[model samples]
Target chain A: MTAPRSTTTNEPTDPYVDLPVPDQRKQQSWRAQGPIVAMVALGGAVGASARYGASMVWPVAAGSFPWTTLWVNAVGCAVIGVFMVLITEVWAAHRLVRPFFGTGVLGGFTTFSTYALDIQKLVAGGHSRAGLAYLAATLCAALAAVWLAATVTRRLVAWRQR
Target chain B: MNWLLVICGAVVGAPMRYLTDRAVQKRHDTVFPWGTFTVNVVGCLILGLLSGAVATGAASSHVQLLLGTGLCGALTTYSTFSYETLRLAEDGARFFAAANVVASVVAGLGAAFVGVSCAEALWA
Candidate 1:
């Protein structure tokens, strides 16, 4: 005679497909994140300093638009794209370095705040068309530059890998 | 009287931006740059709100500098966003590149408009 059994039944789980498992390798790799942050911060400091220097060197000329800011943003965007490609594909840079140079430095170097301020100043000064033109150029050209940098990097990397 | 406040505001705003970017990156390990997008949109909105407030005299110059220059300046990042979008296109993620551009500009402007309108209404 069989004894009365409990109603609960446990099903066998597949370790690979059904069970949630922590990736130790991924976690270990992320140990590099701290260094990345430092790199980014360093990059930020450099970028900010460069921006200040640019402003001082090229004080706004008597113009309808703020040329200094436009130049800085455009240059910064292009540099960042180039930097990303160089570090990621060419150099295969350490992950920690990315934050400092890419996120922190270049990120800090570029300034949307200044961009907005410039636009406001232009609008306030009744140079609305100039302000709008500046905005368009910044948005479009910056994006294009980034795409170009990335494309160049990818092709180079592919050639190397092959 | 107010310049001190602006300085302090900038100090707080810039670091906050750095931290936020880090946090977003941690959560999403993809190279698509969700963090930059979020920061830019939020920063634009805040700037718009501050602009409206200052124009309406609802906020002080110090407050404006703190929130607008320091905070927003630190928060929104065009360089990184541009870089990442370009990276995606280069990596053959054309769809993502297109989406990033459209979404960032549209959302940023929309957020700014809403922020400005909200501030104007409240101050008025």
Candidate 2:
């Protein structure tokens, strides 16, 4: 998978990004959790299904390295990064949505076991350098992705508010 | 094809993660995120054993899907781990952020090693 060359890092400037702030006209409280939870569940279902579909389509070829896993993890990380920012800033998506898409779907979609297995396979195949490189790249990229997404989303939200 | 098993495993694994995370939070009363750390490490170990077993022809694809795809898939969560670590860093808990990184990577790798060894021993 192709990596995003530049990372985003602006925090949301929108005062009311995702919160349904209370005012004389309306009040927001824990009561909103019910609907939020439902939204999360729905997002989780979609995320999980997409993950399964990806795995099925990109099955590991026999005796080959874990291209399928590498692709999935990288893509999942990037998507979560974007989705997190989108929901938080742009769409001002509900609070429950993160749990479904981020925690449930993306969390399930990205597999540490496969990551470990990929490295093991590389070492087993006498490609120790490649294995280590893969590991380093995956960890660094995944973390940066989230941060960048968060920063960008925050900025986008702020701009929208202005 | 075995969708039922995968779903069941995920349900069990997810709730287990939630309860264990809450328990860890309750006991430690710290921001260390011990629960996610524990789950990831343990998941890596179990997955390692499963992978080893499959490699050595001791396990079947169905078993792999059930345990690997369903259970381990649900058990270990990278997103939460990433988000928490970032939150820690953002909140100025730099030490916690560093600890989160070292602990997860090192322990996760170690657990996978143990699992592989355990599975190999079974065959040996």
Candidate 3:
């Protein structure tokens, strides 16, 4: 998502590198998708397992705030910010690397579904305050984490390159 | 056993997300990230339904572990969503960044609630 399209005012966010060229989608044949999809799957398994393991190790008690998931999501968001910057700007790595690590592993590791569901459960369980707090906190934390991480990573990369 | 179920579900769920993202993204040329948006909402909906079903005994814990914990968890992602939003802001598309966050949260929460109600009507 860090594609340098900001030079032109009309340029849209060329977010994901995997997106096929507009009107040239036919070029992205099914064959090109095989390895990317496989890598995503493989990375996904590792990510989901790690998440499950974390929850197992630090199980959120019934009716308690889901701090574990909040941390997981925040950490994932931070890591992604750094990773996206490095992968898109600094690293000239393999193509499959982004799809595997970024889209697959981190995506699987941090879940929006559980976050939403947890808030729902908290509210339904007579913990509306906790739900509201969590709802706001996770959003704030995720955004802040990504913003700070990306900023710092960019600075570090620039310094090293200089 | 539970770990295996989660892994199996993730093996399928992650790829499903990638392919779905590709399919959705290729359809449009906008940078709004509708691909991630769609999957998050859909995943929340399914997880909500499963939660309701479990609450009402319509689904077992095993199924919940497979579908809810593994499938929905892998299908929807906070990292990508946040990263894209960050990119939009960095690229000076501030409006899109704000809208992306607001819309995703509202839609995701709404879908979760709707799914729960639907499940309550159907199974509960």
Best by DockQ: 3
In candidate 2 chain A, where is summed lDDT lowest over 10 consecutive residues?
A: A8-17
lDDT of 2 by residue, B1-124 (tens): 6665566556555545544554454444355667788878888998989988987889998898778777787667766677667767876667878888787887888788788888988974
Could you give the CAPRI-style class of model 1?
A: acceptable
Stretches of candidate 3 exceeding 4 Å from the true structure = A1-28
* Candidate 1 per-residue lDDT over residues B1-124, each given as its tens digit: 3434433444444445566765664554344556677778888878888888988999987777556655576566778677666656655667767788778777776777677778889897
Candidates ranked, most accurate by TM-score first = 3, 2, 1
Candidate 3 docking quality: incorrect, acceptable, medium or high: medium
Tens-digit per-residue lDDT, A11-105, candidate 3: 42333444433444655655677788898999888899999999999999979989999999999999998988887788877878887898889
lDDT of 1 at A28: 57
Model 1 bad stretches (over 4 Å): A1-46, A52-63, A92-96, A113-128, A147-162, B1-15, B25-32, B58-62
Local accuracy of candidate 2 as per-residue lDDT tens digits, A110-138: 66766776677677678888788878877
The numbered model that scores best in lDDT is: 3
DockQ comparisons of all candidates to the true complex: 0.24, 0.26, 0.60
State the weakest 10-residue window (summed lDDT) of model 1 chain B: B1-10
In candidate 3, list every pair of residues with a backbone clash. Answer: none
Q: Candidate order by DockQ, highest to lowest?
A: 3, 2, 1
* DockQ for candidate 1: 0.24
lDDT of all predictions, in order shown?
0.63, 0.66, 0.86
